[model samples]
Target: MSNRGETVNIAIFTNSYLPFSGGVPTSIKTFKNAAEKLGHTVIVFAPSYPGHKSNGKGVIRIPSVKAMTYAGFYLPVPFSTEITKAFRRYDFDIVHVQHPYLLGETGMKMARKYNIPLVFTYHTMYEQYLHYLPVAESIANPVMRKFTTSFCNHSDLVIAPSEHVKEFLSKRNIETSIKVVPTGIELRPYRKKFRKGSIKRKHRIPQASKLLIYAGRITPEKNLKFLVKCMAKIAKKDPDVMCMLIGKSAEKDHYEYDLKDIVKREGMEDRIMFIGDVPHDKLIDYYKEADLFLFASKTETQGLVILEAMAAGTPVIAVDAPAISEFINGKNGFTVPQNMLKFTAKALSMLRDKKRMKQMSSNALKTAKKHSAENMAKKLIAEFRKVKPTQDEYENMRSLKDLSEIDWSDVIKKIMR
Candidate 1:
């Protein structure tokens, strides 16, 4: 640890970052900003893919020799041990691992070798990932659960984004100390533009058209096909009703193309538009312009978009899952059953009802102001300080794993000192 009295230096390991706008990437971005604000230095180690560009703010981009995307999911082909070697040299105070993938695994090994306290944040539900791997759920879910549980077990502290995730891990004996820190959003940017803004005109969206928007990756797990299916019905009911999807396709450009083809086939092409990717600063515009926010995915561990949309003053129409329900309620948005037709009907019903629609928008903005990234970062820093080893605990972390190998009296004296 640096002699710089309580100043923290965190090395964050994540599979993806900006140029990628899903739950995990966004969380890192916000957390980094918050940490810096709290007088801490944060360095992010993430995958360097096609759209990823380094901002040069202590974040190091480790490029993948090869990377591929399928159906909007990005997979970085496992690469060199150069990262692990460098991490040992950095000697960071804490190593926080975001995902349980290749980068995280390498970081974990480095943490053990270097005697650094390791913390893990549980993000996605990989058990639901079996279907995407082209494996049967019966065979895939157990394997995925095992992998995730083992990853959590290795950490000194496990930070779960929700109570449900905490419960899931505890049921399986991930006995590490756990903290339920709901992911926080930075509200200043979104809340400042509470009323309608120039985002509609900037996107060539006509004033009379009621814009329905979905701002996320165009992936199967996201269940975007249902939104395309509903666009036809929404268009029939209100010709002025326009559905716009503003998100980038990671490795899943083909699936995105298929959806575009669906629009052309349904003759609903002109009614829907796709804006592949945009800068983080500009994303608030889409959220600001939407009359209603729609997310159909039940696969998310926590639907950050639902909170983001509500923060941007747009009401959400989401599936009734724990992740969705945790932040939203009847006062702020509508929750529909997971069935396609029901989802579509609920989305349309919310959009068409002007009085109820306006009220939800108000409730959404109020709810969103509370989830700022600054607040979340503050909470995380507090937790890191709490879980960090005391003089005695540090001795244990620095000692060999085998209890029999240590000089007990000398070690305890050093710890007491």
Candidate 2:
């Protein structure tokens, strides 16, 4: 193992990456950028996107086909000669994977081959997103749960983005060592001062309008229809309030149309604006311009955008969920129950109280500072150090006749428990 302060070489395998906008890609990018700055080397293996050119410095693109279930995402081919060549060239101390299947499985195989410690970051609630699978939910849910549990057990370290996720994995009987290291954001951009109302001015919204912003992929799992209902209620109570949904819809599932339709039905066409696909660098300006950040997604493991909004000093009003309830308090923001009436009431109350909002905004900034990229990267490095094998351990692992010795029946028995 490398010395405590010595640089470590990292191999990251993920099903998704740059040019694809989502939490997984964003988290990978953030960690890569921050870790590189700290003199560590990170090589990422990800699916190649059509018409997207990669710089090819540290990222290796695996040939992939577009997934039928997910519109924009591509399914990576498991076997790659390029990845084999990379293993021969780079001496990786640890292999970190972002998903449990496909590319993640490949990562596991490669880690075993090289006798490197394996780390898996459970970035999503697989069961919550099983609707994307062509198989029936009843069959898919339990199978996915079992598969993920087995995968986590195989990993040397399992990273949860929040304490709730860690607890959830424990309940599912994941025997691997679990750590909570949230996807962190660069604090400078959010902390920097920008022209306050630039986003509103660009969208032709009045400067005095109270803007409520929600940023993320527009998919069914996000529960955006509920947010529209909440927005409609808030708009009815305050004529000066407006909402901006700042993301594009999934390629296959254009749920944004449904949201627009709901907005129209609520008679909020003028009040609710669909500002689609803003660049990540420019998103901080929108967050800064917003009076409050609105999030209703119950499926989130970390709700990364909520933290991004808080980083920009925007108080968030989120629906109570395991991950959300961990950070959002009365000081930073409010996390109300899923009930629309209660959620909307808290939002309206917060909007009406200027002094309280200002105090919360200050508290939110402090909260964001605690989750900065540098801090999270240090935590990740520490975990990596704990799991990384020494030279003698690596040699012993390499001497093993077969690395794929896990019993599926045993994994199933544990899942049943």
Candidate 3:
């Protein structure tokens, strides 16, 4: 075997995948793409959603008996028989699970039944999901902690996307091997050029305006209302300050255009611009066009967009939270103390200082260089090599019973008849 190690096939399982348009989906795509480039065969199993396509190449959609459809897409519950059966035939060397709960649990089972080593990447803190699940913290927190710890402990390796998440995983007392590997950026040779000219013309952002760009989904966990609130405060002081709210909204009433209503009601509409979801291919243009990037989300295992903005030579202004604070330590960008008013004022300070803007751009570019796909691939490849199918388990998996003997004809007859 080459010193880089023998190429092993890996199957990744997640709740959502590409063309779904979210940070997690994008990170999943990036890893799959990078893994493939490293000569490892990679495939994913995810649900088909609206405006989402599954070519069925390297992807198998799970059938759900019960689903919660939203925006024309259905979320499959964990351990759907289709998923369990579909995975059995794949014969992967390793199963890497992303996200938590149902689908992740399915991955856990596959690792056991198929004798494949498993790895789990903890991408989000489900602390926010408890309220959505309508469960009290006393009940939900323990459950979340239990599942998280259990999942990590089951894995051959648990990859944390940020130092903050690694620490979080450690605190839960997950005894598995843990590694911190960043979701990397595909650095462009002419990326700096993409920054200098793209933002100014494409978005109609005036050269005189101090553009503050925010990327990613306009979701609740982002803590975006404060961004609007901060914009209003900044608008009160400087009319030339323009806040461009990019990305698709998660909730119509609670998240999106309503923010515009708030801005208009406050007579601050002129200062804040809501530009919905920018396509991935042209995202670099938006970064290049902006003078500074503003990210206030308290929820992130790692903010890939923050690195993207920095890659475009745009400094980020983010709340001092987890992954955000880990990558930015007052060197490449400014970190606010999660105080809304303070964040607004800190953003406001960037307006009058042209020299500081230029310095931050250089610093951002310098810091962003550390987060590249090659670096991440090295770490991920190491983890993949550390895991192997054992003699007994491998033999047992090959002898495991197939679902065909279970007689699913009754269920099919009931559904069709």
Candidate 4:
């Protein structure tokens, strides 16, 4: 593990990438860009999107079809002769896979063929995402767990973005080396100079309104319906308090319409605003402009947005979930159960107290400083150095002819179906 200053090449495979914003894409881009700044070469292999340009940036987009159920997500035709050729040319030192399906399996095969270390990041709790599948939960739950266990065991090392994910894997009895490394953001971006009322003025948010921002995907697993109900109750007490739901839905989730319906039914549409997706570069201003960050997702590995919000000196009011338990200490933020009354009471109390919110905001900045992107990149690079493949092992691996003989056309066709 002695490649501190030496240059190394890393090949990353994922089902999603930029033009699509989320924790997975943001985490990969942050670490990849940070590693590159340290003189390492990183290449991303992701699914191609319709009417979107890669514009270079070391990304190789594979041919794919738009996932109708999960809007903005593409299902890639994994069998690509061109990708195989590119793999042979780049000669990456290691392969890092973001998800444990489709592109992940392909990455594993290529890693074995080249006799390189294969590392998998356990980003999502597959059980939580089973809602997206049309299959029955009784059947899909075990299948996903089995598949996840198999994928992690096959890897040289498993990277867990948080202790919560690590604990989830431990319970599954995965017999692989697991490391807990929290994904970080470029703190300076959130700390940069931005006009104080710019976001509110542009969005037509009233100056006297007490702004609360929720920045994440709008999906069922996020427990957003409950949030809408809570906001409706809170609105009756303080009409000046406004709640904004930021970011696009991970899919065109049915929950989105339901949330809107609840808002309309309760006559809280004026108080609650759905300000679609915000650009990543300009996201900081929203965080900085807001008084508090609202996160109710029970299914996050690390909740990168929480850290981003903290970096902007905004305190978070979230549910008592394992994913975000590590970040909150009561001083920095408040964690409550899923109960609407309890959560609303806490949110209202925090908003009413100016002194407490100021202290929490300062504490939030202190917590954010502890998780720097540069430090996270260095930790990943250290792990990469620990998995160097020997020359004889590389020689013993499969040849290009053997790789080509495997029929991936059928596999790609199946996924397309």
lDDT of each: 0.73, 0.86, 0.72, 0.83
For the record, the alpha-carbon RMSD of candidate 4 to the native fold, in angstroms, is 3.7
Of the pair 1 and 3, which is ahead by TM-score? 3
Q: Which stretches of candidate 1 lie above 4 Å from their native place? A: 1-5, 50-53, 69-91, 130-141, 191-197, 250-253, 388-417
Using lDDT, give the best candidate's number: 2
Residue runs of model 3 more than 4 Å from their true location after superposition: 1-3, 54-57, 64-73, 77-91, 134-138, 189-205, 388-417
Kindly list the per-residue Cα lDDT of model 1 for residues 1-417, writing each as its tens digit. Answer: 444347787888887776666788889988888879878889888777666565568777665433222333444433556566556556588888897756776567666666677789988877765444433678657656766676676677899888777877789878789998777877767645434647667667688888888888777777777778777677766788888888877444477888898888878877888877767677787887788888778776678888888887789988777777777788899788777678777777787788998899899987777777877777777777766532223235332233232232332333233
Task: Please give the range of 10 consecutive residues that has the lowest summed lDDT in model 4.
Answer: 397-406
For every model shown, what is its TM-score relative to the native structure? 0.83, 0.92, 0.84, 0.92
User: Could you tell me which 10 consecutive residues in candidate 2 have the lowest summed lDDT?
Assistant: 392-401
Compare candidates 1 and 3 on lDDT and give the better one: 1
Residue by residue across 194-282, what tens digits does model 2's lDDT show? 98778888999899999998999888888899998999999999999999898877743357778888899999999998888888989
lDDT score of residue 43 within candidate 2: 96
**What is residue 261's positional error in candidate 2, in angstroms?**
1.6
Q: Give Cα distance to truth, residue 242, candidate 2, Å.
A: 0.7
RMSD of each: 8.6, 5.2, 5.6, 3.7
